[model samples]
Target: MRFQRSAVLCLLALLAIPAAAISQTMDYDRLDARLTRLAADEDMVGLSVAVIEDGRIAFAKGYGVTEIGGEPVTDDTVFRWASLSKGVAATEIAILASQARLNITDTVGSFKTSLRLPGGGEQRATLEDVLSHRLGILPNAYDTRLEDGWDPAKIRESLKSLKPVCAIGECHTYQNVAYDSIAEVVEDVTESKYADAVQRSVFVPLGMATASIGRSGLQNSPSWARPYSKRGRTAGRPKEKIVNDNYYRIPAAGGVNGSIRDLALYARAHMGLVPDVLGETALDLLQTPRIYTRREQARMSSRYRGTVRDARYGLGWRIYKYGEAGNRVVGHRGAVEGYRSFILFDPDRDTGVVILWNSSSRQPNGIGFEVMDMAYGLPFHDWMELDTSQAAAGH
Candidate 1:
């Protein structure tokens, strides 16, 4: 009897998919079939996705397996949100500032002691710079080195070393070291660990019970999904090596575990669900364009070519004015080894989406785009997450 029970358990384990390819409606059935076929071809362990429409789940489903060696993704499968974690940080900043706990105008020099920008540019860096990637702080990638006594002084050392390629707002260099510096600020202001502040301000308020700030010592919950990459998605092992990559430094810019559904709830709230979460006033301030990246403006999607309008960059988001068809969309995408994710929303339509994928995402929702369109707007997801927002009322 024990042997039979173990066999049953094993069979059930093999059935896990991170977010299934099965979307919930006939309109999405075509994409559902394609995702089903790709789940096999790509060899994706699992993927879980959801679309927020008219304030409810238009569609939500899981697919494939959870980890390469695990079960399939279910509605509950947890995924590492990667850079999508920025929105969580942005949410905290909004809440704190709304309560007058901190000021967005506070300078980096004010927070971190003993260091100055290589050319003294940081003296001018305000809180807005840290949150918006506008501060010409260090331009390294995920380079946070948190020691036991890591203090404001060391952060200054990090900032003083950045090679200012240009003036503070001149170049929009998407950076992790700079944002992690903001994480340090979050710690200082809240008098809480960065992770703790994130939990209190964003995770808990949104009722995302599964969300976690840092690594856990506890055993893997049944919902935890393994990470996967594009190479691994195609004929490689379903579970790739968990490495000394993205999670090790655990910068504020990254490091949050979540599910597609949970993230959508968080995203939907940005559309004024209860501005009490961040306060409508503070939410408005965070979305304004503080720095515009010339790099992004000069480039156009290959698909759009010559006809593309110069894209714009806001404080924590990419700002743009699309045609009537484009006005309804906004959000961001995140990627790391063995995992990739997308979170976009249609503020005008009160819609949002979270795509928690264990394998490579050929985004703006490659195989996933079709189903995504049915829920919100279209495929216009861009990189850069710090809670990207659309035109909200009054700053």
Candidate 2:
């Protein structure tokens, strides 16, 4: 029985296509078919994906519906970027730094922001520290308050009272509410709203026409995927949820919405392909490995652990040493209450994949790795954990 089950799982992972053929080239047609199957297998509420190859969008598609029984999702369907907005904040800050408008090395206390570290730690924390999530306070310090109707300003003000867990720059602490402090920095330096600064610095210049900031940016979209949650009993589909504006309250941390196409262009810009918009110096600073992320390394699956030997955090990105070849892949994953997103790109090859879904399901996370593994000509490892899933379904 065990051997038979293993055989079935292998066939499912291969999806009737040989591993060698799958790795020979970045096959978009095959990828589109595979994504269709994967979305059905995962019962996703809505999904949109874009692949970047040779410095351009090679494949972009959508699967499922905007809502359970509503309109079908298309490439133009807008989905929330969630914490992926961090990369936007980092990129904008880098651009400002290059323009001599603000220096990342400037201390947090130097700016008119509400982030106050214990024992005057904010005096030592720099804009770079905030971007790299080295604030030294507890991880996600005021996220609960931020989610529970507390205004971002008030939550930031309350941070002054919390004791420091580690001194500034001593450890890599992941933050959302605290990380949004960059918004204040951008506002002070640009003398404008953070969203407007991002628009001027990023979206409009990159031709990301569908991209916009804040909750209304998502809700007002003519073709937007409604948020969905997989709660309650055994179900045929996930339940649609109200688009919570809590995360959007922290614009720099979790408030950006766009189509899959916009995300692909954003990734290309980071690869230094869109030089006129983002120069090499700013790109380097945004992606350079700054701190070792031991927590991330521990959380990765055993299969990926062998290939991704090191896990580190850059300005607003996650850097990894992918496969035995040790090629660098910059990527990030994000989750809000009812949405999930993942992006992975190889800067050297100028190849990457971005995925967005309007449900809480995490199944699509592995598709990005599958695409990367094929691009690198590596042997298949079923990064999607389909074997375990098959067992669960009694396949």
Candidate 3:
């Protein structure tokens, strides 16, 4: 009888071990000190960071000022999402797919009949093609045109003028205009504007109150971080100056804005905490690797190359494989003229990080990875130190 009791107690203790580890508090004090020092060193105007662990927000805080000697950034301070909008847009589209409103495999030209490849006959690009960056469209072929006030319709009409750099589904080429065509596809399917669809489907469901899409969204925001760019060279110790550019024309590509707090909810949804809001199937589909994005290895800083074994593009997220076992990390990074943002999550560990900055710099990515490492209790790397070294070496 004593042996049985001892065995039961031992089993209970063993069962509590995993739960205890999962519930452990992260070293927020260390993170805070590091972020404060890095912001000062990098001349960052304002930054917001949030970490999700065990399917909930574990830590979230803002650093620095919204502008030079301006308002302090808070959890609710909105910032331009830039290309991070891609992940949000993809999530909404996946929701539509879950409801059978549209099939991701459906040819994009089926809805936007005007959009055609170079030959202009049968549409070779499907909805997945555009979402996964496998449309074979040359990178940013018409991004300048979109930025110059050209409407998405005009860009769609102009598709015939541009040729695919590679065969459809054969190569990965990042795009803005081509991906924005998903907006038109969504509009055709829902008979509503893209922003409205996103607001109704994604923001409302996720309770992301401060999240909005496009120029009007930012303008109407009650509180938002002012856009700023580093004044001189990338490595120069310079001040940040306020700057602005309108990207509403390509809303689907890079036009969403939200606060770090709101983004934490989105991250939680992706981590499978809110399955009823975003179906598990849809979430899986959005994150499942679709095409090899060879650019990640070459584009990422050399410091991260040691851990990142492979990379791929999913529906709207960039999937990174770290270590030999290839630990899965799904995330997206965004860069507009004056803003930089990143959101990274590990589904296996149910850990995620969101970093939004009003200033454009490579520091956010390194900081995000460090936070993730901390969440998983992995060996720490001094990313900021490496960043400083790279900058001094003119890398």
Candidate 4:
């Protein structure tokens, strides 16, 4: 009958709705169950997560207690982004480049940084090289000095004294001090403090309400999660930790602080959702693969080791091929003492996961892929390693 034919057409149309639109309505019972189990786990002190689909937040929630028995974690509970802050710097640079305010190809020596590479490598090295970890210096150069309370500026000044591991632009040698030196260039060009420029350009325009830079930003939050660890005499029980300002001193490489909501918004903008905040050109510039990261690929979880391949470093991001389809996925993970954060998203699909936890557990690392599996219509896998007691093992 005509009525039956019309009903069939209507049903087909409804089923044909773009996945992004229906993603908002997708049942999250599986995710909720996993998060609930994680929150109650022995090693997980406090955690918050946000899932994004098509540039919209599909789900945002917090789990566990802020400080062992302290306040419950909420989406608004601020947590340190740790090295995840590097992405902010990369994003800002991309925006600046789009506006013709600065050139990433400029030599590092031309800036105000004290990054004197051996054999005049700084002269040969470009700002893009610095952001992409192509400094050819020792990995995490001067990180130990920074943690030991040495003056950050002095630490940067000492980078020139280190030996080169490879020629500049030949290999990916990560650096926190040398990396943070980009802040000086940003300050010079923006005619404002690095943090102020980031605030005005990225955070404010993207509406990252609780996002901020520095130690004060984390401590000053109305509700912030305290870092925790199972070290010392804790008998494997996570204990509250003091918030160290050492890494915060290198605000560009680290020191970003924000809530789950703020991070989700940040990810959404990076997905090219907020055109007013960021455009495709800026996103492309920030995410283009610049250097292969073989060590990074080796560090992947056993579950992902097979599917995630050809790892590479971008401006401040990590790019890898995922799934049987070899889909390009952009992601980054960060850790600082007792806190761990992971962000993974498919820019093409505009879907990703952001996780923040205030403990030394890497259990949540798998959750990002679990969400992505659902997005990709792949079968479920125990990427979270929930069955194993080794979930508390270091990332």
Candidate 5:
């Protein structure tokens, strides 16, 4: 009896070791499969995802239908990175600033004399304030009109009519006004348009052969996925909403389009792999937190949970805690009319992930959620694990 008990105990111990080891290794495939299940949801159209591990793209894949009833999104699909453009534009501005070509803290009145703003009739804000959401203009999740639609012109127009909710550096309010001013600043200083700057400063250097801030017409250009809206809606926009489909006019704010791989390449650029479009010092300056936004706490908690410690907003990127001692993790997400996008990297680890979905409404930002989770291999108890445990129970 004693011998039999010992044999059984040894066998159990042996099994326990492997189970413990298995537990340590997260099931990313199952997590991805669970993400795949999201396709069965109501509005998701298509998605492309790339995971960068240790400074290089380790895996890139796409799923779901690119069009409502068309082919599944392949790795080649391009998506509009709405607010994500803020990061790129901010980076561009920062690069220019570092070269003494631009300054975030400079007054907008000096950039364009024709441009009139509302705050104090002559209130000035910095490039950092605008892109980092610290201008304190509004949209502290309060105003409805400022939340959506095409209003770059109106935002620019309102400058002379609006008042600074707080002092120049008092608080952070993520809005379009500062970014628009930055776009104008880019053109004013560079003597070149934002698109022209991107063409010369970034796109060309990265060899982004097909990327552009072209209008909605180009959203469907070669090597791109067709733009889409939430289900039961349009692809581009209500014909009335489009003012100048060419967002480059305000590209410094939110006008960019490119492929998942290309965007990943852009993220890679931030990690110092590609030639310095903005140079190493310029990129370094961008990672520095200009604003510590408690406003983003709730949203970051909801999306990233424990992964995002208190974060600071860089010129355009969201800086999060990366290492055990709160090392900074920098990345950005873009949301256009129909497409949604996210690109982030851990500069210390030289690792990042970029995911772009052709349709923004249906799939939502879950792609960014899952990719970030998987990138760090954060142990999570999501539905996927529940389903896996259940299946194991059955066996």
Candidate 6:
């Protein structure tokens, strides 16, 4: 029975690799034409993309205008990073852990005593639990509370009122408040605010000069993309608007704003191209898959269909295993009110892609997949056909 079970598992894994031809070299002209056409077909307001190769940016470009007939989007046009802040937060925590400032095993109650697991159980969730979305809290637990203007301290106190869907480390659920709790941990351990610590440890070290946290960061920036949303079914263009709320309440979870250029630098550091900025052990810990996520599995199963063998959640990334080669892809995507962004990389190849856009109607994941296909030499697919079909049907 044991041998049969093992064989079954192996066969299931083999079924996950898609049959496709591999290219010998990246076709830049084809890639550029596809992206430009995709942007137009999707009615994207403004899009900026950067490709990192061998620890440096190989290609960086922008498309469309920042506003209607206004300034053109550039590689430096800042966009709200949204949930991608979780990746930055995870890196910062890993740095602190490496420096012996904080231990991942420390319980949450140690820093914020008010937060107690339901039923008063002594097995409090640890920092690693929160970072990896294994805190057992229901997905997006107390996110509305934070959005409704409740302070983090009050939200922390309110955690006791909520119940976990499973025991700590038993399952995976995406979170914002639980992830943001690390900011407090950072402040307590380093005697500095989370934003300050992240800037000093990550942004400064990586030379991500334009990267900043929260509302003040966006406000201070002179060249930033304004938020936009689709107006109507056939609006043809997205309308510019302001996201008035301050994400500082949960800055560590979803408050970052930066450009594709800066994001490329961050991705370079993750690829082990910049050893002096980020240590190998730290990056490994951050990228190591901790808890398997059903949400990720379902998403990848639908996205890749026959291809993805497994999908799991790391500290702040979604890990996808694809192709016969079982190439490991680590990446994160983010969405705010009127913006969407995606950053993905193949660490083994030390190549990655960053996509930032101001409009919310169309996500950049398809573009990320295309870039991944190029980086890995996989045969390209018409990723935009489904979206185009949907739009046509709606019309």
Worst 10 residues of 6 by lDDT: 13-22
CA lDDT, every model vs. true structure: 0.59, 0.83, 0.76, 0.83, 0.62, 0.74
User: 226-342, model 3: which lDDT tens digit per residue?
Assistant: 777665634563355444444666788887999998888888778766666776789888999898877777676366756664789999998887654568888988998778898
Q: Candidate 2 clashing pairs? A: none
Task: Estimate, for each residue in 246-326, the C-alpha lDDT of model 4 and write its tens digit.
Answer: 888889999799998889888877777666678777888888999898788787735475768889999999999888898
Scored by TM-score, the top model is 4
Instruction: Show the lowest summed lDDT stretch of 10 residues, model 1.
Output: 386-395
TM-score of every model versus the real structure: 0.77, 0.91, 0.88, 0.92, 0.78, 0.88
The CA-based lDDT of model 2 is what? 0.83
Note the clash tally of each candidate: 22, 0, 0, 0, 15, 0
Q: Which residue pairs clash within candidate 3?
A: none
Better of 3 and 6 by lDDT: 3
By descending lDDT, how would the candidates be arranged? 4, 2, 3, 6, 5, 1
Candidate 5 at 114: error in angstroms?
5.3
What does the lDDT come to for candidate 6? 0.74
Steric clash count of candidate 5: 15
The TM-score of predicted model 1 comes to: 0.77
- Give the range where candidate 4 is weakest over 10 consecutive residues by summed lDDT: 1-10
Model 5 residue runs over 4 Å out of place are 1-32, 113-123, 140-154, 231-249, 322-327, 361-364, 374-377, 383-395
Candidate 1, 1-395: lDDT as tens digits: 11122334323222322233432332555545655655564335677777665445556678887766567787777877778777667777778888888788877677743445667666787767666776554454324453232443465565666567667655566765456666777777888788888878787776777777655511155677776665533344444646333442444666777776677667666655545465557657755656655555465354333222345544455554333345534555677666777766655555556787776545334433344345434444322111234211100
As a TM-score, model 5 comes out at 0.78
Q: What local lDDT does model 4 show for residue 309?
A: 86
Q: Write the per-residue lDDT of candidate 5 for residues 190-227, one digit (tens) a residue.
A: 88767888778887787666577856524555545565
Candidate 1 ranges beyond 4 A from true positions: 1-26, 112-116, 137-156, 217-219, 230-239, 243-248, 297-300, 303-310, 322-324, 361-364, 367-395
